[model samples]
Every structure is written in C-alpha cells, then in structure tokens.
Target: MATTLDISTTYYKSPLGLLRIGGTDTYISEISFIDHLEEGEYQANSLKGPVTPIVIQCIEQLIQYFQGQRRFFEFPVFQEGTEFQQRVWNELTAIPFGKTISYLDLSRRLGDTKAIRAAAAANGRNNIAIVVPCHRVIGSKRDLVGYAGGLWRKKWLLDHETKIQYGVQTLF
Candidate 1:
C-alpha cells in the first residue's frame, strides 16, 4: 500500500498573533493564521499519517524567527499551487527581508506586466507566509494594501524589518 503523508499542527504565538503550523512527515504542507485556516482544516490534515523531519525543522526555525533570533530561513517547504504562483513566490523570496516591492513591479519582474491581479492573487494564496516573503509585496501607490494577516500586521512586519535593518528596537 502507498504510504500516506503524516501531518501535525501546533499553535505558534508570534508578534502577529497565533499562527497555525502544519506539516506532513516529509515537509510542511501548510501554515496560516488561526483566522486564515478554516476551522478543523489544520487538525484534519495533521492526522493524515508520521511527522517529517524537515517540517519539524521548519517549526523550530519559525520559533526562532518569531523570537527575532533568525532573519532568513534555509528549509524545504512543500506547498500546492499553480506554476505561475510558484514562480511569483520564488520572486517574492528574492526580494530580501526588510525590503518592499510594488505589486506592479513584481508583476513586471515575473514578465507579466498585465498579470498584476494574478500576482496579487498568488500572494494572497501564499501558504508559507514569511518564508515565501509575500508580505514584502506592497501597493505601488500606497504604503500598504490587502494582507491575509491584516494590514496592521503587514505594517508591523515591514516596520519590524526596517527596525532590524536599522538596528532599532521593534515595538511589535
């Protein structure tokens, strides 16, 4: 019989709030805020089978990130999305922590000057959150735009990154 991917979940209290982290025996299948994850969705998924080492490692790294002890991550992540979404996410990671990019700019970098909406949608559906660096995307005309974790969280994250870069203490 084919082996099923084992999954598990736990709550992580961060500056943003409580985040739900889920993973399979081989990798993290999903990570989202409590409000973002449909009720029972994470629980149902975590029972699918043994936890993966990579996922456990991701969990540890996430804790470190939340504690502000780590800046960048070096872990394997497994997420499901379209090829275009994956491409957009790849570009998001390249943005570097503490920097911001306009959605239109990101679209152009992806070679899709007309796919701004698609780019935003891809960012909206990003499951890996900070790891994928989706928060780095901003509106071309404004300081903040739509964020799955809320605009306040977006601002806090950006400001936190800025503080870290400038050697200033973050209020959040």
Candidate 2:
C-alpha cells in the first residue's frame, strides 16, 4: 500500500492578481500568482472537501495584507527545496515586511558573499510568494530586479509596503 497526502487548493483574488493557494490541512504549501483563475477552480468560499483551515487563513491574511491592515502572516507554509535553497528562503522570512535586502547582502548573510547568484537563484525558486516574500530582494545598487510575478508587481508591492510603513511612497 502507498500513502498519499491530501492537499486542498483554493483561489484568491488579490489586489496584485489572482493567487492559487494550496496546502495540506495543517500547513500551506504554495501561494503562487496566476494570470487567470481556471474554470471550476475552488475559490476561497467554495465548499470543497472541507477546505483546509490554513488555506482559508492564508486567504484572509492575504486580504488583510493587501488592505494594509496586516504586516505579517501567521499561517505556516511548507516549501520543498534543496538545503541551500531552504536556507535562502528561511532568510527571506527574516526580512522585515517593508524592508528590502540586496542579493549580495543575502549571500553575505548566508556566510558567503560569493554566493550572490546562488542566493538569487534560490529566491527565484521560491514557490510560496508573499508569505515567503521574495519580492523584498533587490539589486545591490537598489535597483528593482528579477521577480517571477513581474517587475511591475514587485514595484507595486514595494511601493505599497513603503507607503504602509513610512507614510510615503518609494520611487523605485
């Protein structure tokens, strides 16, 4: 006999875009942006096999985040990655909600400034989006760069966080 994991998925319409949320009953596994919601997809409100509590919580937190009423998330997330990638993703969580860290800085934090490219690669491979917060990483020169969700969305997220944290908008 083989064991199987029961995963529940739901969709959330966020201010940034449509998000596909997936998870087991205990922990959220993924929250990636999608260009469109596929037909017959289970939305947050749909009764689909007793929707996971964590998934609902994720959607609620995301909603609060977009509304600027929440800064940090409380739901647990589980992403599968290599040991190095795990380290990089873990470090990303430490980045303050509205603060940005350069790839060089992230690499240095990982104990090797030479691993900048590796760090950036790990950041890019992150499956969970806002909660893991890959958008907080930037270029060493403070330039906006490399976002799987698109640079425009990255810029918007940065500006939104800045406005919420500092009462002013960021130009970059």
Candidate 3:
C-alpha cells in the first residue's frame, strides 16, 4: 500500500494581501498570495491539523520580513518543477535581497543568453512567491514586468525591500 501525503493549508493576512501557506508536516510546499480565502479554507492561525513547524516558521519569517527585521528566510521550501525550472528558481534565490535582476541577465547567468524567455517563463511558474523572490526579477529596461501577483504588488514588494535595505522609500 502507498502512504498518502497530508497537505495542510493556512492563511496569512499580509500587508500586501492574503497569502495561503500550504505544506506537509515536514516541509513547506507552497506560499502564494490569494485574493481571498476559498470556502472551507482555514483562516490565519486557525490551522486544522498539527501545523507544520516549517509553515509556522515561514509565517514568522514573513512577518519579520514585512517589519523590515528579516533579510533572509531560514525555512525550507519545496516546489515541484522541471529540472530547468529548478535551475531557474535556484538562480533566483542567489539574487540578493533588495536587488533586482533582468531576465536577460538571469539567462546569461544560466549560461544561455538565448534562454531569457525560458527563464522568465520559469519565474512566472514559481509557486513560492516572496520566499523564492520572483518579484525581484525585472525587465531588461529596468521596468517592472511579468509578475504573477500583478505589477502593482510587484512594485510594492520591490519598494518595500528597497526601503528595508537602503532606508529609502522606493527604488523606482
């Protein structure tokens, strides 16, 4: 018989919007913003099962991050993707906090300047949002573009990080 994986979900009311955090008892599987809680979904801190430690840690880290008290996350996150997508996500993590990288630059870093579109596609498919820092990727012209969470929220997140890192209000 095959054992089943129990996936637990919880909500977080972030400054930007509502975020849904999902994970197993061992590792976090998803943390993405939700416009609103769906019916039957647990509210913030009202988790049903034994809450995963990593999920709680992700929430704490996110709180600290919004408060400008955390620069790096220590929680472990897992996302299912192709090897190429995995490579793209891994490169995204290397992008320093409060900094931005262009899709072209990202492709070059991946050792394929022609793979810009592929890299950007992988970025859009990233399941883990802020933790993976997909918002940090910008267009080649230094303009904000292609954020799955909406351009306004992307700008807000970049501005937030800039203020936290440079003590300035905004970068753009």
lDDT of 3: 0.87
Per-model TM values vs. the true structure:
0.82, 0.90, 0.92
Q: Give the Å shift of residue 121 in candidate 2.
A: 0.6
Q: Which candidate would rank higher by TM-score, 1 or 2? A: 2
**How many residue pairs clash in all the candidates, one count each?**
4, 0, 0
TM-score of model number 1 = 0.82
Q: Please give, for residues 12-105, the per-residue lDDT of candidate 3 as tens digits.
A: 8899888888887777778887875557554444564567787889899999999999989997778888999999999999999999999999
**Tens-digit lDDT string for candidate 2 (13-72):** 788878878887788888888875456654443343457888889999999999999999
For residue 30, what is the lDDT in candidate 2? Answer: 81
Error of 1 at 91 (Å): 0.9
TM-score for candidate 3, residues paired by index: 0.92
- Model 1 clashing residue pairs (backbone): 6-49, 7-46, 25-51, 25-52
Candidate 2 stretches with Cα past 4 Å from truth are 1-5, 36-49
Candidates by lDDT, descending order: 3, 2, 1
lDDT of 2 at 90: 96
How displaced is residue 172 in candidate 1, in Å? 14
| Regions more than 4 Å wrong, model 3 | 1-4, 38-48
